[model samples]
Target: MKGYVHSVESFSTLDGPGIRSVVFLQGCPLRCQYCHNPDTWQMNEGNLVDSAEVIARVLKNKNYIARNGGVTISGGEPTAQIDFLAELLKGFKEAGLHTAVDTSGYVDLDDIDRIIDDTDLFIVDIKHMDPEKCRELTGRSNEKVLALLGHLENLHQAVWIRNVLLPGFTDTEKHISDLCAYVQKLQNVQNFEVLPYHALAKAKYQDLDLPYKLDGISEFDSKQLLQYQDMIQKYYSKKFSIQHDAWM
Candidate 1:
């Protein structure tokens, strides 16, 4: 089967463990306000390639991936194209490569189940904890996202929770505490990442002629990010008995 692919990054260090070959799949249901790859929103506007072709491309740099690193399917929400993603993950797994998916966790549970067995890691982005605020930021409710997390937990899937710290929007003590509390209950959560918000995607919005929702919002400085990370680590350590290094 052919997958609509936006692009590929051969060597990505931050996507998962060690280094990885990141596949940027096309199409996303959520219109996240801070999305940098706005061009990947359209399902039909990408290079259609068979799973073999994509796998071949990744294998070209197999040595670089080594054991700790492998392949990651990102998007435009990779699970939006479930069949193709499943096929791609199967191919990666068969090749002895660690597979990871970077998703918003807004996909249907069935779609996720189709590829979960083949996936090694899930980098889930939790936009916002509050349902209304989640809708405001991502143009979708958090119900499906939360449900996806629950499903993954039920299956005992390994997951890395990623939260974007948007100042004045999602970076409040109430929000962080609530999120930490909820995450602490998930037994399958392997890591927690607090990503600082940035305006790097504003130019992309301008290029795509799309209205930038967070136009005036300023990016958080290093100090703010460090503080948030410290707070989150402290909460996780104290409440869940998971060390900061274990999840970070």
Candidate 2:
């Protein structure tokens, strides 16, 4: 099956462990106000290519990626196109490349079950824990996301949880503390990160004729990440890092 692709990054260190070939699939269910790539919001708006084609292109750098990293299926929301994502993940695995899916975990269990076996890791986005706040930020409740996280925990799937710390939203002390505590309950967490929010996508929104929802919000200072690290480190004693411009 063909997948609608927003773009592809041949090499990326931020999406997952080691170096990775990141495939940005098209479409999303939520309209996250601080989304950096609003250009990828539409499911049918991108170039369509066969899953085999995407696999072949990524495999070209197989010697390096396979040895160091692997393939990462990221998106607007990779699971939005379940069939295409499954095909791509399966293809990556069959070719002996490690595979990871970076997603919002906004999809249903049955839908994502297709790729669970093929996916070696899941980088789940934690938009906001409060249902109302989450809905306000992304136009959806946090129900699905929570469910997906629980599912992954039950399966013992390796996960990297991330939250974009936006001002007046997810940057609150209570939010960070609760988020950190919640993550501690998971057994297979590989990484926990807080992506510093930035207004880097304002230009994209302006170009797309979409209103910059967060027009006045200043870029989140990278230094503020340290305070959060210190606060959450008590709960998350494993791997935690201050994510700069690297989170999707």
Candidate 3:
């Protein structure tokens, strides 16, 4: 089967463990205010590549990505093209490679179930903890995203939680506390990351003739991000069995 692919990165250290070949698939259902890749929102804008072609690309870089790395199918939401993602992950798994998916976790349960067994890890992005705020930021409710987390926990799937700290928006104590509280209950959560928001992609929005909703919102400094991370770690340590050091 073929999938709409926006781009590919041969070596990505942040998307998953070790060095991975990241596939940026096309299309997304959300119009996040802080979204950097507005270019990927269009489902039909990318090139259609067959599963074999994608697998071949990963195979070519197998030597470098073999140890702790493999393939990470990221968005525009991988589940948007469920069949292709399932086929790609299955092919990579059969080749003895670890596979991961970086998603917003807004996909339908049925689509996710189809590829769950073949997936090694999930980098789930929680846009916000409050339902209203989540909807305001991403044009979608937090219900599906949170539900996906619970579903992954029930399936015993390893997950890395990513929360972007958008200052004056998602950087509030209440938001972080609520998020940590919920995440602490999930036994399958392996890592919790706090990513600081940046306006680096503003130019991309201009190039695409799209509005940068986060315009004028200053980026958080490293120190501020560390403070937020410290708060999250402290809360998780106090509320969960997992140690504070487990967070990233």
Candidate 4:
């Protein structure tokens, strides 16, 4: 199977456990206002290549990934091209590497089922808890996101929940509380991370000729992130550490 690939990170310690090879695929459904990789929005823009070709490249750097780390197929919403993603995941498994998919979770269960078995972990992004608020920020409803999360729960799939802390939108007390409440419902969550927002994508938006909706927003103070752990403990009890150290 073939798919459009935006880029590749040969050694990324922040994308997942240990060191990993990150396959940045092209295409995303949600137009997240604070998105950093706006270049990946167009489905057909990136270089098209077969799954085997991508796998071969990743395996070439396999020794760099060592034992714990493996492969992560990230996106512009990787699930946007389910068949291609499934093929890549299947290849990773056949090669005896741990597999993971970093997704927005705005996907159909049927589509997710294609790669679910092969994926060792799911790095899910939960943008907003309120459907209307989610729509306002992402230009899409959170219904599909929640549905996909629920499906993963049923399968007892390993999940790492991620939420970007946008200053005015997602950093409010109510917003965080609502997110914590929802996360409490799931018993299979391995980690819950609140990513501090960064406006490093300003130039990218300007270059792409797209309006930067989060124009004046400043980067979040990551040091203050520890306070959220106490808030999360009120509703759920599990790991609540910062997982996006790569951005730092």
Counting clashing residue pairs in each candidate, in order, gives 0, 0, 0, 0
Kindly report which residue stretches of model 1 are placed more than 4 angstroms away from their true locations once superposed: 238-248
Q: Best candidate, lDDT-wise?
A: 2
The stretch of ten residues in a row with the least summed lDDT in candidate 3 is 239-248
Residue pairs of candidate 1 with colliding backbone atoms? none
- Candidate 4 residue-wise lDDT, 1-248, digit = tens: 78999999899877778889999999999999878899999999899999999999999988878498999889899999888999999999999899989999888899988888899999999999999999999999899999999999999999988888878898778988888889978988888777778888889988989999987777755466666556666666666765445431
TM-score of each: 0.93, 0.97, 0.94, 0.94
Q: Could you tell me which residue pairs clash in candidate 2?
A: none
Clashing pairs in 4: none
Query: Considering summed lDDT, which 10 consecutive residues are worst modelled in model 1?
Result: 239-248
List per-prediction Cα lDDT, in the order shown: 0.85, 0.89, 0.85, 0.86
**Model 2 clash number:** 0
Error of 4 at 143 (Å): 0.2
Write candidate 2's Cα lDDT for 28-141 as tens digits: 999999999998999998999998889899999998899879989988999999999999998999999999999998999998777899999999999998999999999999
Position 234, candidate 1: lDDT: 60
Error of 3 at 227 (Å): 2.7
Descending-lDDT candidate ranking: 2, 4, 1, 3
